[model samples]
Target: MSSSRVRKEVDEALYAFVDRQRPGLLGISEDLSPMLSALDVLLAGGKRLRPAFCYWGWRALGGADGPEIIAAAASLELLQASALIHDDVMDGSDTRRGQPSVHRRFEALHASEGWPGSAVPFGMGAAILLGDLTLAWSGEMFDTSGLPGEVLAPGRPLYDVMRTEVMCGQYLDMLEQARGTGDVESALRVVKYKSAKYTIERPLHLGAAMAGASAADLEALSDYGLPLGAAFQLRDDVLGVFGDPAETGKPAGDDLREGKRTVLIALAQERATPAQREVLRRRLGDPGLDLSGVEELRTILVETGALSGCESMIDEFAAQAHVALAAAPIAAEAVAALTDLTVAATARRV
Candidate 1:
């Protein structure tokens, strides 16, 4: 099947699973409908890249293309949803995928209805529960994906590790922000654990293991996956600062306002002159940062060569990913598809 077809299958499976839970959720409390509604909207967005990686990884090991695999891949979408929801809450972001964030939606609902408690707390509470719900459902989806216990057994450890490491990485991310880490090494470390492994390497490993891939094949996928994942996040960081609001869904320079200490920002800070550093420190995380302030920060980022440096790093990682893919023992078709996916993933506006 084509990648689009696989994506469609995953979408259908996800909607079906969510629809099945709607009644039970409503029975518990009609107010819970908004949470699920926001989830439905959130799920409709995103590139479904993780599932695509998972599907292609399974294909690399010569696993047959089947509904079971699609269902299994769809579980990753739930995990992504959970992560994004929580990440937005942590960042104090107001929007996601160009819509009000889960929390903001609930917050608005609270305000509109003149609810008893503070809207801020209510929104945060609802969003937290919504994220928790998605996290719980992700495991359920995987367990019931129709992959036999014997098939899932091998990949189970990696699955557990992916979950555990992502939470650890998230805490690390929060800590880095709290500590104001602007060094390139610390920023890269956060990227590796928070995004690189969880978002790419482990998902590939999970699918490959499900296919009973050999150690050699698994290692090859990691070699391909790790650098590629870093490159993917680097691209995201660039877009976060410079991408169009229409395409990125968030306001322009949203990452800056949120004070995301990404690799791009760290590089700029590292190379900045004293005056430039002073500007960065004062204006980067300001919630009320205006467009002119954003322009100034962008100028500093460009003038300091951080933008070019990050672009160079992206090129290096993409090249490394290709080299690893070429050396892998996977089928020719799988390699070809992965090659295309590499470009689509790293080069896209979204």
Candidate 2:
């Protein structure tokens, strides 16, 4: 099946599942409606990249296309949603995919409804529950996706590892922010487990496992996925700092505002003069940062060569991914699609 068709199927599956939850949710309280609705909205966006990777992985290993596969693949989207909602809360971000983030939406609802407590706590609490609930549902969705026991069972281990790795990666990310990125290697470690492994590599592993792939096939997919995934994240790091809000669905310099200890920032810190380092230490992570402060930080990043260095890293990883793809022992047709996916992933505008 074409990717567009798979995307459509995934969307339909997601909405259908959400609709089924309405009666149960409304029974708890009419007030719960907004949270579920907001989830649907949040899930509606995104590149559907995880599901695409999963589907292609299955296809590469000679699995046939069908609704069962699409539904199974769509489960990854819910996992992605869980990760994102929690990530936004952790970062205290106000927006995601150009919409008020789940927490922000709940926070707004709290204020607008004249809820008694502070909106911040209420919103954060609600968003956390929403993420937890979504995480559970993703597992449920995958288990009930109608793949036979043998086909689904093998993939379960990869799914389990993917979940654990992501949570651990999230903790590493939070720890870095608390301690600050002392070096590029530490920052890149966070990127590896958090974005690279969770985002691409394991999704591929899961799909390939479902198809009962050989050890060599799994190795090849990993070889292709890991570098591409890293490049994909480096591109995201670049976008977080310099991308247009309209294109990135984030405020310009949002990463600077959040004080994320990205590899890009770590490089800038390494290369910065004492005076420039002073500006970074003071302004980065300050919630009250203004436009001029953001510009100054951007300037430091450019002058110190951090921006170009990150771009070079991306190019290098992309090249490595291409070499891996060239050597992969997958079907001839799959190579073409996987190569395109590598490019789209690292070259995405949003």
Candidate 3:
């Protein structure tokens, strides 16, 4: 099936699953209406890439196309949603997907209603609960995806490990921020655990495992997925700095304002002149930074060759992914779909 068709199926499965949960929550209390509404808004957008990877991974192993597999793949979306919601809270970001973040939405609701106590705490608490709820729902969706028990057993361990690794990666990311250093090695580590694996490798592994793929097949998928995942993140890092807000759904140079210790920043710091370094140290992480400050940092990133270096890295990683994919013993149709997906994911504007 085409990637677009896969996306449509995944969306149907997700909507059906979530709709099934609504009455149960409403049964407890209709006050929970906003929680469902927030999730609806969040789910309405996204490239649906993870689930695409999962579905393709299953197809690579000759798993037949079915609603069960689509539902299973769709579960990954909830996990991704949980991560994004909590990530925005951690970063104190004002918007996501061109809308107020879940916490901010709740915060605004509290203010508009003139609720007692501070709105900030209430917003944070509500968002946290929502995130946790989504995390739990991810697991529930996977387990109840209508796959038989024996068929689902093999992927369970991979699903558990994926969850654990992502959480650890998230903490490592926070620690990197706290340490306030921009070493290339540390930043790469954060990328590997926090994004590359969660976004690609594990989803592929989960799907392949469910399809009864062998150890060697799993290894080959890893070789293909890991580099592609890294390139995906590197592309994201570039977009965070240079992409148009209309395309990216976030402000330009937002990463700089957030002081994200991305590989681009690390490379620039490594090669910066003293005067340029001073400008970086002063303006980076300044939440109040303006357009001029952003332009200044953009110039430094270019002049230091950091942008070029990042582009080169993305190309190298993509080449590696292509080579791995060519050698894998995947079905011909799946091979073609995955190749297309690789480009769509890395070369995306949003």
| Top lDDT hit | 3
Model 2 residue runs over 4 Å out of place are: 348-350
lDDT pick, better of 2 and 3: 3
Instruction: Write model 1 residue lDDT over 19-105, tens digit each, in one string.
Output: 988999999999788988899889989888888888888999998888888888889999989999999899999999999999999
Off by over 4 Å in 1: 348-350
- lDDT against the true structure, per candidate, is 0.90, 0.88, 0.92
Query: Which lDDT value does model 2 have at 160?
Result: 96
Clashes of each: 0, 0, 0
- Candidate closer to the true structure by TM-score (higher is better), 1 or 3: 3
Q: What would the TM-score be for candidate 3 when compared with the true structure?
A: 0.98
- For 30-141, candidate 3 gives per-residue lDDT tens digits of 9999999999999998988889988898999999999999999999999999999999999999888988899999999899999888999888888999999999999999
Count: clashes, candidate 1: 0
Candidate 3, residue 140: CA error in Å? 0.4
Give the per-residue lDDT of model 2 (tens digit) for 22-118: 8999999998888888897898789888888888888888888788888888899999999999999988899999999999999999899997979
C-alpha displacement of 264 in model 1, angstroms? 0.4
Q: What are the models' TM-scores?
A: 0.98, 0.96, 0.98
Instruction: Give the Å error, residue 52, model 2.
Output: 0.7
- By summed lDDT, the worst window of 10 consecutive residues in model 1 runs over 341-350
lDDT of 3: 0.92
